[model samples]
Target chain A: SAVISQKPSRDICQRGTSLTIQCQVDSQVTMMFWYRQQPGQSLTLIATANQGSEATYESGFVIDKFPISRPNLTFSTLTVSNMSPEDSSIYLCSVTGGSEAFFGQGTRLTVV
Target chain B: AQSVSQHNHHVILSEAASLELGCNYSYGGTVNLFWYVQYPGQHLQLLLKYFSGDPLVKGIKGFEAEFIKSKFSFNLRKPSVQWSDTAEYFCAVKPGGSYIPTFGRGTSLIVHP
Candidate 1:
């Protein structure tokens, strides 16, 4: 299993402001992903952060709203742009190693 | 599109009682299955996974799941429940050799002492 960590374990932000969550892994990995878990709902894939290229967004999500950056194999960042109350959710970063995927301590974002 | 479904939204059980959670996937092709557990205020952790070979897989905390390919189901079971087992359980599926997984709505298990 990989040891994953995320910055800003919890944060409160005003509407129209943006916040960035960073994920760092203990070792190099081939793929890193970002997911959103809304209150009382299951997790939804936001995007696949690919190193040196644009992240692949899932349906119902776009790069304009959730821009991602993967500068190296062990690190990636996801920025929630122009936040809103509806954007309040727990953001998680995960990586697949071997056959199982490991998740970080999610960042809980609350937009007011 | 592929997806996962967990039958129970919430389940309550007493210590020493049996526990079972149903999970189904909607993928026709070969797929990989996983079960994750999230304790209160804790990150999600892998419980068990079934990629191939054995249909029955065992995980930590005395948890086990059987993958029935014919029914597209993977159900988790524990012979005896513990109060500390209260948590949210998620079922996830991915296509064969695919890296991305689709997660279910999750089942909240409350085990009473």
Candidate 2:
């Protein structure tokens, strides 16, 4: 399993402020996934990040709102641009290792 | 497109009670099933998975799930419950050969001692 370190674990930001969450993996992985869990809702895939390429965003997500950067195989970042209260949710970074997917301790974002 | 469904939104049980949570998926092809648990203040952890072979698979913490291919269901079960077992459970399915996994609305389990 890959050990994924994500931060900041919890944060409070103004509605118009942007916040960037970083994910670092202990081992190199081919792909990294970003997911969002809204309060009282299920996990939804935000995008799939691959090294050396642009991220593929999901239907309701966009690059301008949720920009992603995958500089290498072991590190990636997700930036919530122009925050809103609806953007407040738990963001998780995951990597597939072997047959299982390992997750990081999610970043809990709160936009005031 | 693939989607997962978990029948129960919330379940409450007494310690030592039997437990079962229903999960279903909609996909046209073969899939890999997974059950993940999130304890309070903890990250999601894999409880079990079913890729192929046996339809019945056991996972960590005395948890198990059965995959019924014909029914498109993978229901999680535990013979008995413990207070420490309280957590939220999610069922995810990835179509065979696909990199994306679709997750179900989680089921919140509350086990009272």
Candidate 3:
């Protein structure tokens, strides 16, 4: 399993503000996945990032609302742009180890 | 593309009772199945997994699951429950030759002592 460190562990931001969450891995990985777990909802994939390439956003997500930057193999960032209360959720970072996935500690964000 | 379904959204169990959490996936090709548990405030951990060969596989902490290919189900089971078993369990499926997994909506289990 990979050791992933994500921050801010939690934050309460005002509406229309942006928050950047960082995910650092212990070792180099080819791809990193970003997920959002809304209140009482399943984990939804926000985007998939591969080093040096553009991040692939999911069906309902876009580069404007959720822009991702993957500068290297072990690091990536997801920034929530112009957030609203509806954006309140626990955002998670995950990487595949062997055939299974390992997750980060997660960032709990609250937009008010 | 693959998707997973967890029928029970929330489950309440008493200590020493048997447990079963249903997990079914939609895919016609080969797949890898897994069960993950998230204790309150803890990271999601792999409970068990099935790749091939054995249809039933055991995982850490007395958790087991059986994969029925025909039904496209991999249900989790435990002979007895403990208070410590109270957590959110998620069933995931990764199509063969792919690393990305599709996660179920998770079943939140509450075990009273």
Q: In candidate 1 chain B, where is summed lDDT lowest over 10 consecutive residues?
A: B94-103
Best candidate, DockQ: 2
Please report the interface RMSD of model 3 to 1 decimal.
0.8
For candidate 2, the docking band is medium
The CA-based lDDT of model 1 is what?
Answer: 0.94
lDDT tens digits by residue: candidate 2, A18-112: 99999999999989999999987889999999999999999999999999999999999999999999998999999997668899999999999
* Candidate 3: true contacts recovered, fraction: 0.58
Per-model tally of clashing residue pairs: 0, 0, 0
Write the residue-wise lDDT of candidate 3 on B2-21 in tens digits.
Answer: 88999999999999999999
lDDT of 2 by residue, B1-113 (tens): 88899999999999999999999999979899999999999889999999999999999999999999999999999999999999999999998888778899899999999
The TM-score values for the models, in the order shown, are: 0.97, 0.98, 0.98
lDDT of 1 by residue, B1-113 (tens): 99888999999999999999999999999998999999998889999999889999999999999999999999999999999999999999989878988999899999999
lDDT (tens digit, per residue) of candidate 1 on A12-52: 99999999999999999878999999987889999998788
DockQ of candidate 1 (2 decimals): 0.76
Put down candidate 3 lDDT per residue, A3-70, tens digits, no spaces: 99999999999999999999999999999999999877788999999998999989999999999999
Taking the candidates in order, what DockQ does each have?
Answer: 0.76, 0.78, 0.77
Give the poorly placed runs of model 3, Cα more than 4 Å off.
Answer: none
Give the Cα lDDT of each candidate: 0.94, 0.95, 0.95
Docking class of 3: medium
